[model samples]
Target: MTTYDFSNQTAIVTGGAQGIGGAITALLASQGARVAIWDMDAALAQETAERVGGGALAVQVDISDWDSVQAAIAKTVEVCGGVEILVNSAGIAGLNAPLADYPVDEFRKIVDINLNGTFLVNKAVVPVMTAKGYGRIVNIASVAGKEGNPNASAYSASKAAVIGLTKSLGKELAGQDISVNCVTPAAARTRIFDQMQQEHIDYMLSKIPRGRFLELDESAAMIAWLVSSENSFTTGATFDLSGGRATY
Candidate 1:
C-alpha cells in the first residue's frame, strides 16, 4: 500500500540487469522515474532497460574498475540529463571457505568488486548530486557485514566497509540535502546463494529467526523508497532486512 510519486527524478541502479538489481530497476521505472541500468551483462541489461520503458537505458560497465564506472556514470548523466539517485547493487560473491584455506587473491577480488566498486561509483556520481544539492543514495550491503558469517570473511569484510563508507559519506553530505544510506539484507534468494556451500547455507538459515529467504522484490521496495523523496529524514543508518536475525 506504499505509494510514491517519482515522476520527476532520474535514478541509476548499478548491476541492475538481474536478481535483486533487476527488481529494483523495475520498481523505480514503474514509479515513473527515468531509470538507467549499469551492468556488465549487455544483453540482459538491455532487456531490463526495455522492460522499464522509454527513457531507460542500459550501459555495460565493470563496477570494480574505476575508469569503467566513471565512464558509465558519465553516459548515464548524459542520457538522463543529470543523476538524482544511485543504488549501488553491483558486487561479486566471495569464496566461501576458512581464512587459512582461502586464497589471498580471491579475498582481494571480493574486496575490490564489492567494496572498492561501491566507493568508486559513489565518488564518480556524488559530484553531480553535490552540484545540484539534492540526491539520495542506497548502498546494498549484507547481514554478513554486521554479524560476520564464519566462512564468508571476504564478503563480510567488504560489506562492513560499505557500512562504514555510508556513515562517513552520509555525514559529509548530510548538510547538503543529500542522504547516503545502506541496507544489511540477510540471505536473499539470489545467485549469491549458489556461491555459498551447503553448510554455510544451513548456518545462515539457523541464525534467521524468521526462517525464510528474503525476496528480491522485498529488498527492491526498500531501495526504491530510499531513492524516493518520501525517505527524507534518515541518513547514515543501516536499515535491516535480516528476517529477525540481526540483534543490533
Candidate 2:
C-alpha cells in the first residue's frame, strides 16, 4: 500500500459515516490526518469517528441546507482548526423510473441533495482554503454524469453539474495552491444501493466491462493521493473510476 504523509493535516469527508465516504475517512485518519466525518446520520458518524480515532470528529450536516453546511464548517474549524482537505462523498441514487414517470418532488429532492449540496459545501470551504492558499478538494461524481443512464435522469444531471462545478472551481482557485478535482466512479455496494432498483443495478454492472464493482479501498487509495501534497500539478480534472465503462 502506497502511503502519503498527512500528518498534522485536517480533512473533512462529507457523508463519511459509511460507504465510500467511510472508507475515505478511515484511510485519511490512518495516514495521520485528523478527519472530520460529516454526515446526516449523527450516530453513525460518531461511531465512525470513534472507530477511526486520531482526533476524528463527527459533524452532522444537511449539505442541502446552507445553514447546516455553515454550522458544520464552523464547528469543524473550531475543533479541527482548519480544513486542508475535503472529499464530498455525500450523495444519493434516487429511485429508477422513466423520465415521464419520475415524480416531480423526487427529482427536486435528488437535485437538492446531490447538486445543490455539493455547491453549498464547496462554497463554504473555499474561503478556508483560500485563506491559507493551500487545499485539496475532491468531489464525488458518478459515471452516469458522463454517460447518461436511462431512468436515472436526476442523478445523472446532478452529478454532471458536480463535474462542471469542480472544473469551474478548480480554475477559479488555480492561482492558489489549492487543487479541485472530481471522480466519476462506477457503482459500489453500499447503503445507497438500497434506493436503487435491482434492474438498474444489473444494468450498471453490465455496462462495466470489468464485470466487477469498484472497491472501497481502491477509491481511498486514489483519493488519498489526490488530497495529498503530491497532487499539486493537477486541478480541474476528472479521475475515472468507472472500471472501463467510461469512454473518455
Candidate 3:
C-alpha cells in the first residue's frame, strides 16, 4: 500500500468507530498519525481506539448537535494538541421508500445527521485549521447524491447537500493552506446496509457498472490521499469512487 507522512499530525474521524470510518481510522493510525475516533458509540469508539493501538483517542459525539460537536472538538484539541486532518465519515442512510411515502420524522433525522452534521463538524474544525493555516478535510458524500438513487430520497438529498457544502467551504478557505473536499462513493457493504432493505440494496448493486459493491479499503485509499498534504491543490472538488457509475 502507498503511504504518506502523517507522523506529526493529528486526525479526527467522525463515525470512526466502524464501517468506512473504522477503515480510515486504522489506516491513519498506521501511518503514524495520532487519531481521535469521534462517534456516538462511546464503547465502540474506545474499542476501535484500543484495537488501532497508536495512542488513538475516542470521544463520543453527536455530530448533529452543536453543543456535543463543540465539546468533542474541545476534548480533541486538549488531548491531541490540535487537529491537522478531519474526515467527516459519520452519517446515516434512512429507510428506502418513495418520497411520497417516506416517514416525515425519518427524513428529518437523516438530514439532521448527514447534512446538518457535516456542516456543524466542518464549522467547528475550520477555525482550528485556520489558526494553524494548514489542514486537510475530506467529507464522505455518496454516489446517491450525484445520481439520485430511487427510494432513497433522504439519503440522496442530504448527501447532495454535502457536496454543495464542501464546495462552498473549500472556496471560503482556498486562500489558506487548508483544503476542503468530498468524495462521492458508491455503496459499500457496511453496517449502514442494515438500515436498507434487501431490494434497495439489490437496486444499488445493479446500478454499479462494476457489478460489485465498493470495498472499505478502496474508499480509505482515496480518502487517505485527500486528507494528505499531497492533496494540496484540490479543494471544493468531488472525487468519484463509483466504479464507472459516475459519468461526470
TM-scores for all candidates? 0.97, 0.99, 0.99
Candidate 1 C-alpha lDDT tens digits along 1-248? 36677787888888888888888888888888888899989999999988788578999999889889888988888778898999999998877898889999999999999999999999999999999989999999999899999978899999999999999999999897899999999887777777888889899889999988888989988887888887788999999999999978
- List the candidate 2 regions with Cα displacement exceeding 4 Å: none
Better of 2 and 3 by lDDT: 2
The residue ranges of model 3 lying beyond 4 angstroms of the native Cα positions read none
Model 2, span 1-248: residue lDDT tens: 89999999999999999999999999999999999999999999999999999999999999999999999999999998999999999999998999999999999999999999999999999999999999999999999999999999999999999999999999999999999999999999999999998999999999999999999999989999999999989999999999999999
> What C-alpha lDDT, on a 0 to 100 scale, does residue 239 get in candidate 2?
96
On TM-score, the stronger of 1 and 3 is: 3
Cα error of candidate 3 at position 198, Å: 0.2
The digit string of per-residue lDDT tens for model 3 on 151-200 reads 99999999999999999999999999999999999999899999999999
Local error of candidate 3 at residue 186 (angstroms) = 0.5
When superposed on Cα atoms, how far off is each prediction in RMSD? 1.0, 0.5, 0.6
* Overall local distance difference test of candidate 1: 0.89
lDDT of each: 0.89, 0.96, 0.95
